[model samples]
Target: DQQVKQNSPSLSVQEGRISILNCDYTNSMFDYFLWYKKYPAEGPTFLISISSIKDKNEDGRFTVFLNKSAKHLSLHIVPSQPGDSAVYFCAASGYTNAGKSTFGDGTTLTVKP
Candidate 1:
């Protein structure tokens, strides 16, 4: 299912800069939008998330913005460090069954020092 899509396959940025990742979804039933960062040999680690009730949410250096009308979302990481380099994934889930999540193809980000 083309429920979610991450158009960018990869991104590169200098250390201490901002890293922005984009995501799009076709389902309007989605209630949650989340971003996860996965390093090699490890599972995806949750970064930030935004609920359908909220347009934007921020935690420390990470921010997640959701646009319900357009079915689009984005994750922003400020002052990204080299360790932040990884495969970032965008996932969506409906409220009816939060456990049933649909994920987009991940975008690999390289933060060069």
Candidate 2:
């Protein structure tokens, strides 16, 4: 079973608007969650992250929220710009995994001008 899933394969938003990306996990052991942004022909870059102990984390225009009880998490980007358009991947890791992470298939986000 896929432990991490991004049910929506894609999302679209206009520039200067809010973009929300959702993720779900089936593994209760996951204690850390992360979001990565990937551009074409380049590696994924870390965006924002949240620890299971915390419900929310924010960095600049990006924020990540974790709902431990629901085994769900979301990434929010406000005032999204065209440069923010990319494929976003959600990943989860447990202490026992030795730093290995389970990644979602990814959701392509398009920011329109």
Candidate 3:
């Protein structure tokens, strides 16, 4: 089963604090992991990605860490801003596939003023 799981349906935090989201997977075949951020009625944009061979990847205020042994991953955003509020999806892909991804339902984050 190629299932990705984001247990939390939503999260709320104050601006300038750290925002964290967690994900898990059931598919052992996944070799590449990606994070995508989306807003209402818009397509998801690539945020960060990590290969199965690597443990972590970072981009600016966003960081993603993967633990292959646990089949787990997380995304962290520091000094979270109201603009950062959106839905985050955890995804997995493989070099074997033509860059298609399997995504979790998504976690909605809200940053308060």
Top-lDDT candidate index: 2
Best model number under TM-score: 2
lDDT of 3 at 54: 85
- Candidate 2 lDDT, 1-113, residue by residue in tens: 99999999999999999999999999999999989999999999988888899999999999999999999999999989999999999999985562599999999999999
Tens-digit lDDT track of model 1 for 15-98? 999999999999888898889889999988888888899999999989998888999999998989998899999999987675
**Stronger candidate by lDDT (2 vs 3):** 2
Residue-level error in angstroms, candidate 2, position 25: 0.2
Instruction: After superposing candidate 3 on the true structure, give the runs of residues whose Cα lies further than 4 Å from its correct spot.
Output: none
| Worst-scoring 10-residue span by lDDT in model 2 | 94-103
Ranking by lDDT: 2, 3, 1
Model 3 lDDT on a 0 to 1 scale: 0.92
Could you tell me the lDDT of residue 25 within candidate 2?
99
lDDT string, candidate 3, 1-113, tens digits: 54899999999999999999999998888989989999999999989988899888888999999999999999999989999999999999885772688999999999998
Off by over 4 Å in 2: 96-98
